[model samples]
Target: MTSPQSRKVSEPDAVKLPREIKVLVAAAFLIAIGFGIVAPVLPQFAQSFDVSVAAAAVVVSAFAFTRLVFAPLSGWLVERMGERRTYILGILIVGASSAACAFAGNYWQLLLFRGLGGIGSTMFTVAAMGLLIRMAPPKARGRVSSLYSGSFLLGNIAGPAVGGLLAGLGMQLPFLVYAAALLLVAILVATFLPAAIPVPVHERGQAALKKNILPLREALGLPAYRAVLTSGFANGWSAFGIRMALVPLFATAALGAGPEVAGISLAVFAIGTGVALTFSGKLADTWGRKPMILSGLAVNGVAMGVLGFTGNEFWFFLVSAIAGLGSGLMGPAQQATVADVIGNDRSGGKVLATFQMSSDLGAIIGPIAAGFLVDEFSYGVAFLMATAVAAVSFLFWLPAKDPHP
Candidate 1:
C-alpha cells in the first residue's frame, strides 16, 4: 500500500496554491464553461432541423453516448501518455469539434460533431480529475476536490447566461464562442500545466494494465468504493437526466408555462445547485460523508415526487430548486468519498475513471428510460420512477461505512 507520507509534495500548504495547480483548475473551469455554453442551445438547434421533441433530445443523447464509449479508454490513454499531454489533446479536440458544430449543415453533421466533442470532454475531465487527486495531499484532498468542483459549478452557472446571450445573437454563435474559449483553455494547459511523470511499470506488462483497471470484482471487494459508485449513479440520474427531462415537461403540460419561463426556471435550478456546491466541501469534511449523501438523495426524491403531482408554476420552480440543492450538496461528497476510499494509490486515476463511468452511464440511460415512461404512461409516472431510483440509492448508504484517512 502507498503511504501518504511517501507521496511527493507537489502543492504548497498555504491557501494560495502553486501556479501549476491553479492552471490545472483553471483549465477544468474553462472546459466546463465551454460545455455549458452549448448545452442549453442543443435542443433548440436540433428542433430547427424539423425533428420531433424526442428526436431532438437525441442531440443531448449523442454527447452522453460518446462519453460512455470513450471514458474507459481515457484511463488507458492517461496512464500510457501521462495526464498533461492527454489533457491538452482532449481540450484541442473539443475546440475543433465545437467549431465544426457551428458549421454543421444538417442533423447528422451536428450529431457527429457533438459526439466528437464528447470524446474530448471525457478525456479532459478524467485526466484533470486524476491530476488533481494525484497532486493533492490525502488530508487536503477534500479541499482540493471541493475547489475543483466549485470552479466547475461557477462555470456552469456563468456559461448558460453567456450561452443564452450568444444564442440570441445566432443559434451558431454560442458554438463559435465556445470553441474559442476551449482553444484558450488548451493553450493554458499546454503552456502552464506540469508534465505528469509516468508511474513505474511492472516487469509484467499485463500486471500493470490489470492494476490500472479497477475491475468490478476488485472495486466491489471494497464496500466503500461500491457505495461511491452507487451514489454517483444516483446523483447523475436524479440531478441531471430526470430533472432535465421532467422539469420542462411539467412546466409545459402542467403549469402551462412558455418556453422562456421554462428555460429561466431551469437556469434558476442550476444556479441553486452551484450555490449549494460552494460550501459542500467543508460540509462533507466536518459532518462526515454518510449523512450528507443520504440527506441529498432523500431531499431530491421527495422533490421529484412533489414535482410529479403539482401543476403550479410556483411549485415547479420550488421543486426544481430543491432538487438542485440536493445535487449541489451531493456532488463534492461523492468525490470526497471516492478520494477517501482510493487514498494515495496510483490507482486513484482508474478509480475516479470507474466512478465517472457509472455516472455517465446513468446519464445516458436515465433520460431514455424516463422518456419511455413519459410517452407510454405520463410525466408523473416518469418522475415517480426517478423517485424510486433515488430511494434505492439510500439503501447503498445504509450498510456502507465511511473510509476515513
Candidate 2:
C-alpha cells in the first residue's frame, strides 16, 4: 500500500470549489475565528468572580453541555427550517449571547450566557456540516474537506494571537469582538448565501421515505462511524477539553505565565494544525484513513504526555504545537469517514447529530473531570489523564473499515 503522505492531488483539481462551498468555508472560518478569539480568555474571565478552578472549567464545559443535550434539537431544527435559515438563526443567537457574556455582571450571569450560546453554536455547526456533506463533490471530497477545515484552522491560528493582544486591552474585549464577528457573519449568510437545494422538497419526501434518518443504533454499528466518533471524543477531551481548559491555568500556576503565553500556546497548536491540513486530505486519500488516524493519535498522545511533564513555557508551546499537528493530521480523515458514512443521502441528520454528540459529550465531561483532578492532585495529573484517554481511543479505530481506502 502506498503511504498516505504520498497521495497526489493536482493543484487545479484542489482549487475547483463550487460557489456555495466557498461561502460555507468562509462561514466556518468566521465562526471559528470568533470562538478562537474567546477561548484563551474565557477561563480567566470566570476566575474573575473568585470562582474555584472547577467553576472556571464549568465556564468552558457549559457550552459543550448545552451542545450535548440539544444536538437532536439542532438536527430537528435544521430539517424544519432549512440550512440557510437555521444557520442564520444560529449565528444571531450566539452573537447575542456572546455580547451578553461580555457585559455580564457576575459569574453566574456569564455562565448562563455561555451556556445559552452553545444552543446557537450547535445549530450553525450542524447546519454547516449538513451542507458540507452534501455540497462537497465526491471527486474533490478530499480537497474540499481540507479547505473547509483549513479555513477554520487558519482563523484559529490568527484569532488567538489577536485575541491575546485584545485581552491585554480589556478582558471583555474578546467576547465583544466574538459577538460582533458572529453577528456580521449572520448578516453575510442571510444576504449572500442562497439555499443549497440538494434535492427538491417534493423529491426529498420520497427520498426520506426510502430511508429513515439514520438511527443512532445503525450509526453505532458502522465501523467507520464508530471510529470517527472515537477520534472526535479524544480530540474533544484532550485538545478542546484539557488543553484549552487546563493549560492556561497550568501556565499561570506552574510557570508564572500570563494571558499572552496562554494565547500563544493555543495559537501554536493552531499553527501546527494549519500546517498539516495543507496535505492531510490528499494523504488520507492515498494512504487510507486508518494509517493517518493511527499516526495522528500516536503523535497526539505522546505530545499530551510530554505537556503533562514539562514546566517551562517554551516546552508548553512546543508540546502544544505537536498536539495540534496530530489533531490536524487526524481531523480531515475522520471527517471524511463521517461523510463517507452519510454519503449524499438526505436522511443523515440524526446520524450526524449522534456523531457530533460524542464530541460534545467528551467536551462536556473532560474539562469538568480534569478540573476536579487538578483540585484533587495537580495540573500534571490532569494532563496525563488526558493523554491516557487519547491513547485508548485508538482501540476503537483499529476495527474501522474505510470505503475509499
Candidate 3:
C-alpha cells in the first residue's frame, strides 16, 4: 500500500485548492491579459509623440522604476489593509491609470500615467503573493503556484495576438481595452472574494488574529530565502528584462531574420514554458524544491549561454524554447519555497515585498547593463552576462537547505 506521504507527493491532483485561490487564479489571468495587451504597443505609442528611441524607452523604464521604488509601501499597505482590500484597490488604481494613459495629451502626460500604473501594479502584486502564501495548502503550494502562473501564462499567450488585432483599430484602443479588462477583474474580486479567510480549527484563536509580520531581517536569516532572492533577481534579469529587450535585436542582428521571426521565437518560448508548467509543479512537490530550482537554473543558464552562438533559425528557436522551459520549471518551486518559509499563520508582507523588489530591480537594471554589454562587445557577451547571473544564483542555492512540509 502507498504511504499517505508518498501519495501526497505522487498524486497532487488529489489536492484541491480553496475557492479563494480559484478566484485569485482567475484574477491573474485577467491581469496578465491586460498587461500583455499594452506591452507590445507601449513603446510605439510613446514614439508617436515624436520622442527619440531612448526617450521612449525611458517611458517603459519609468514603470519598472516606480514599481521598484513603491514596493516597500505596497508591502506596508498589505499589512495594514489586508490582501483582498489591497488587491481590489490596486487593480482599481491600475484601471484608472490605464484610462488616463488612453487619453494622455503629450509625452510627459503619458509617461506620468504609465508610471502611476506601476504603483498599483506592485501593490496588487505584493498582496497577491501574500494571499498565496497564506492560503495555499503547505503540501499543495507548488501546485497552487503553478495554477496561478499558468493562468497568467495562457492569458499572456492569447493577449498579444488579440492586442495586435486591436491595435489596427487605433493604438489608444488597446489601452482602453486593457483598462476595461482590469475593471472587470476588480469587480470580480470585489464580488466573489471573502473579507477574511477562516483559519483551521487548531489555528483559530487570539494568536491567529494578531498580526505576525515577518521582518525582512528575520527572513534573510534563512539561507534558502537568501538563495530565493538571488534566483529571483537572476530570473528577472534573464527572463523578464533581457529576454524582452535583447531577443528581437539578436534575432535580427545575429540571425539575419526579419521582425516576424522575432515574434515567432517569443511565441515559441512561451509555448515551451507552458509545456513545462504542465508537469513541473507536481515534480517540484515530489522531487523537492532545491532540485527543481537548481535544475532550472542550470538548464536556463546553459541554454542562454549558447543562445547567441546558434547560427540558424532552428537552433535559435530550440535554445529559446529550452530557456523558457527552464524558467517554467523554476517558477512554482521558488514560489512554494517562499510560501513554506512564511507559512499560513504569519504575515510576511515586507519579506514578500523585498523579494518582489529584487525581481523588479533586476528587471530595471538587467536590460540597461546588458544593453551596454551588447553595445560594447556583442550579443554573445550580453547573453554570457545573463549566464553568469544564473550561475551566481545557482551558487547561492547550493548551500541552502530545502523547505520542509
lDDT of 3 by residue, 266-375 (tens): 88888888988888888888788999899989988889889978999999999999999999999899899888888888788888889899888887788889889999
After best superposition, candidate 3 residue 51: deviation in angstroms? 1.1
Candidates arranged by lDDT, highest first: 3, 2, 1
Cα displacement (angstroms), candidate 3, residue 145, comes to: 0.7
Give the TM-score comparing model 2 with the true structure, all chains together: 0.84
Estimate, for each residue in 182-213, the C-alpha lDDT of model 1 and write its tens digit. 88998887777656432222222543434353
The number of the candidate with the highest lDDT is 3
RMSD of 2: 4.6
Local lDDT at 249 for model 2: 79
Candidate 1: residue 382 Cα off by (Å):
2.1
For 1-405, candidate 2 gives per-residue lDDT tens digits of 766544444332643556777888888898888888998799999999999998997888789889888899888887677667888998999999999999999999999999999999888888888777766665556667788989987787777778888999999999999999998898787777776445322245554534335566777788878778888888888777777778887888878888779878877987888888898887876677788888888888789877867878878899999998998888877777777776655546667777788877777678889889889997778888877877788887777776552
Leading candidate by TM-score: 3
Which window of 10 residues has the lowest lDDT sum in candidate 1? Answer: 196-205
Winner on TM-score (1 vs 2): 1
Between which residue pairs do clashes occur in model 1?
A: none
